[model samples]
Target: MKNIIEELFYGNIDTQARGFKKDSYLQKQIMIMSNSEEILTERLKGDDKKTFLSFVNASGIVLGESELDSFIVGFRLGARFIYDTFVDNITPYDDFLKEVNNEG
Candidate 1:
């Protein structure tokens, strides 16, 4: 199975084709993060990790910091659903998780 970084880039093609600006700082940061697992993992710590996972769960939007609690709940449920529905049926979750979390 592909790692989350690969998955994000794979999914980026459509957005790029739709004329989404690819030169923004956030875009560059995402590319850099996608290529460097250590940097990505380091930035995604504690609340950042929770916010990120929540962003992913909500398809990339957060109303406010206060909404993070609800977002986290949904993120956990969504993660479990994905793990059971997809991860278990394909690659082991641990393997993919390890690959994404690895410092190197």
Candidate 2:
């Protein structure tokens, strides 16, 4: 969970830092909140797509729209790495935060 949050932070920073090309856009929008469910209705219809609900933050250098699968693969790898790291390092919040912050 912590690893996921870290990845979310990095991805969000990167997307805004570099700016996305109109031709190859990627985003990390909020998946949920304590607000109304109006805008989320259409998105919910696409829920079976599964990929849409996941908090995916990506940077696509691929030009043309045919490379979506490739982008999904990249996001999957990023998610798996985060999940694995969290699994291996699970502990109290303070300990985890301490190690994570001190790694650098």
Candidate 3:
């Protein structure tokens, strides 16, 4: 099997394709959002419909940017965790928690 990094680099992995579970909160919310969008699109007319679509498109762009930022931050956080595990010599999570809580 190829390495995960190579798989990702070669476009074999699609992280975003792992969607929410059926009947999950996120799934329910996505359904609600889709229904609301359909209803709103049907109701609006002329310039109002155009404006609504433009707003939605702009919001999608902003959300995509935010998702990218969050992914970068989360990746850095995980890297830092591994770096800390090796450099700080705090092997046990319970000890780390105790130190954080000033119980040590």
Candidate 4:
């Protein structure tokens, strides 16, 4: 099984919702959290935005939350089975490691 962090940037980590902009910190957090099933979101049900996506990656049921609920963070991609190129061993983790500006 490939690492979840690798999958995400490799386009493996899919989400039903993507309106949320991809943040470096958020990506790292998601990658680490991928080890488990549950994920706490930074977005909310309705604050001052339009209809949002119900899920993200691997379609899962949301438990619900005031700030952000457990969003889907995984899904089986058809490309991996159908195409060899899709199943890239050189995952996003490699890229992340290279350009990781660890300055906060």
- Find the candidate with the highest lDDT and give its number: 3
| Model 3: CA > 4 A from native | 87-104
Task: Estimate, for each residue in 1-104, the C-alpha lDDT of model 3 and write its tens digit.
Answer: 89989999999988788878889999999899999989999999999999999998999999999999999999999999989977777543456666778963
Q: Residue by residue across 1-104, what tens digits does model 4's lDDT show?
A: 88978888798665645653577787877767663433334343363222223444324433344224323222234445546575556654455654666642
Q: Write the residue-wise lDDT of candidate 1 on 66-88 in tens digits.
A: 46877689979999998898767
lDDT of each: 0.68, 0.53, 0.89, 0.49
Number of backbone collisions per candidate: 0, 0, 0, 8
lDDT (Cα) of model 2 = 0.53
Model 4 segments more than 4 A misplaced = 1-23, 36-63, 68-104
Estimate the TM-score of every prediction: 0.24, 0.26, 0.73, 0.19
lDDT of 2 by residue, 47-98 (tens): 5434433432122333324466667888899989989887766555657667
Clashes (candidate 4): 8
- State residue 46's C-alpha deviation in candidate 1, in Å: 40
Quote model 1's TM-score. Answer: 0.24
Question: Positional deviation of 103 in candidate 2, in angstroms?
Answer: 26
Which 10 consecutive residues of model 4 have the lowest summed lDDT? 66-75
| Candidate order by decreasing lDDT | 3, 1, 2, 4
